[model samples]
Each structure stands twice: as C-alpha cells, then as structure tokens.
Target: AIDTVKSSAATWTEPAQSTTAAATASVDAAASSATDFMENANAAETAAASEAEASALSIGDYITAGKTRSQIQGYGGYTDIGGTILTIESITDQTITFSIVQYSDSGYAADTVSAKQITAQWVKNTAAFEFCDDTLDGKGYGTLSYENGTIHIETRSNTNHPTKLVLNEDLVGT
Candidate 1:
C-alpha cells in the first residue's frame, strides 16, 4: 500500500515541472520583440529632421542682385533695349521690390514715366510682375515696383531720344 502511494505522488510532480518551463520561455520572447520595435522608431525620426533643414533659403541667396553690365558683357553685351540689370533691394512673403538700372552709354539713368504710360503683366515663379511701355513705336522705358502684393510699372521715353527705350523690362523678362 505504501509503494502505491509513492508512485502516485511522483506522477503529479512531473506534470507541474513541465508547465513551469513553458511559461518562462513565453515571457522571454515578449521582451525581445518590444526592444526591436523601439530601435526602428528612433531611426525614422532622425531622417525626417534632416530633410526639412535642407529645403529653406535665406536672404543671402539673392546674390544675383547688383551685377554690373561690364561684368556680364562677356556673356552678352547690354546693347539692345532688353539689357537691364535688376537689383533686389528688399523681399518679403507677399511682395518683392527692386531697383532697375539700364546699361546706358552715359551710365545708369532714372526710369521716370507716368504711371498711366506703364502696362503691368504677371508671370509665374520667375517674375511676379512685368511693367511694359505703352507706345506706338515701342520707344519708352519702364520701371518695376512690387508693393502690397501688386506690381506697378512706370514707363517713359528718354527726353533726348524717343526711339531709344530707356528702362525696358522686356529685356529682363524670362
């Protein structure tokens, strides 16, 4: 009778040991999976920050401003009516105003035309607006003014020669 009792107790102990081993293995696998997920998330955040910094431009990017005709004469001489140089004085989100100086034989001349004599046109990304001269023989110069989200052009002919256009914005148009 004592031997039968001892055999039954041994059978119960074996089953309990097997169950405990399985539970411990399951816990270890769950911890490993959580660690891998955290590493992948950190890598993605770093890449996004780098891309945003590269896309923006500063005021110094306006280096194209104030280039003289003598400097650019190698590329193309400023002989015709379209040889005007643009100098970006100030720029903002809504407006950009610059000084327009034409390469004259005498030097740089003021573009003075009545507001009514100038015609305004709008283009895409290259130039926001263009001011053209309104005349029969096309012998007037125009000045461009960007203010309050609108462009104003003043066109006038040289007092000495009407045939010679002074500040021709058509030369600068792309």
Candidate 2:
C-alpha cells in the first residue's frame, strides 16, 4: 500500500511542474510585448513634439530691428526704387510698425520716410514661405511671399501686377 501511494504522488507532481513552467513562459511573453508597445508610444510622442517646434516662429525670424535691408524693384507701373532699409520699430499682437529708410544709391543720403504699419498676419510663415496681404501705405496693398533669398510681391491695391525682388543679405546690417 505505501509503495502505491508514493508512485501516485510522483505522477501528480510531475504534471504540476510542467503546468507551472508553461504559465511562466506565457507571462514572460506578455511582459515583453507590453514593453515593446510602450517604447513605440514614446517614440511617436517625441516625433510630434519635434514637428511642432520646427513650425513655430519667433519675432527674430521675421526681421531684425535695424538689421535687415530690402532691395525694392517695381513692376507693372508701381514706383521703383534702388533699395530700402527695414527696421521693426514695434511689434504688437496684431500689427507691426516699420521705419523705412529709402536710399537712391550709395552716394546719396538716406531719405526721410514715413513709418509704415502692416497687419501681423502678413509676416507669418505658411508652409515653406512667409507671406502677407495687408496694406503698406502709398505703395498700395498687396500679397507678398518671401522664400529663399527672393520676394514675390503682387500689388492688389495697385494695378494687380507681380514684382520680384532679390534680398541682399550682405547689406542687411549696413
């Protein structure tokens, strides 16, 4: 009778040991899958934050005060000039006040010009270009887009002609 009892106990314990090992393996696999999911989620979050930062703009990105120079050329009957000095006098929540200094040439003194104000929406960047459609004094209101080292300005308030202007970054500060 004692021998029979010992054999029975051994058979029962063998299956129990196998069941415990299978359960442990299943738990380990679940833990690994969960870790992988968490890692992927973290990577996605980081990419979104980076994209937002890239699209955001600051005041300095538009133009520096007393530090940017714009070469003005007119087309389609608009008044033409050699160059103009650009300075941001004040930037408000909805508008930007500009102090323009016009110059005929290097041999001439800067012309006394009136300050210009334009809506802030015109200076903000959209996609690959920075553009605006706000009024800019006697020159008439138009939509202008700036990209690379060039500006494409179309005067709507004028004769609705497009003008192309090249930016001279070298003369920005001078």
Candidate closest to the true structure, highest TM-score: 2
Q: Write the per-residue lDDT of candidate 1 for residues 1-174, one digit (tens) a residue.
A: 898888988898888888777777777777777777777777777766665444322222121123444533223454432234444544455555454434344333343221122222323322333333333233444445433222334456645446343433332221
Q: List the residue pairs that clash in candidate 2.
A: 122-132
Which digits, one per residue and each the tens of the lDDT, describe model 2 over residues 1-174?
899999999999999999999999899999999999999999899898776655433233233223223424222333433454445445544455443333443323332232244444434532121223222333334443434433333333234432122233322222
Q: For candidate 2, give the lDDT of residue 169.
A: 34
Deviation from native of the Cα of residue 9 in model 2, angstroms: 1.8
Candidate 2 structure, TM-score to reference: 0.41
lDDT of 1 at 50: 61
* Shift in Å, residue 82, candidate 2: 15
Q: Please list the residue runs of candidate 2 whose C-alpha ends up more than 4 Å from where it truly belongs after superposition.
A: 62-119, 122-174
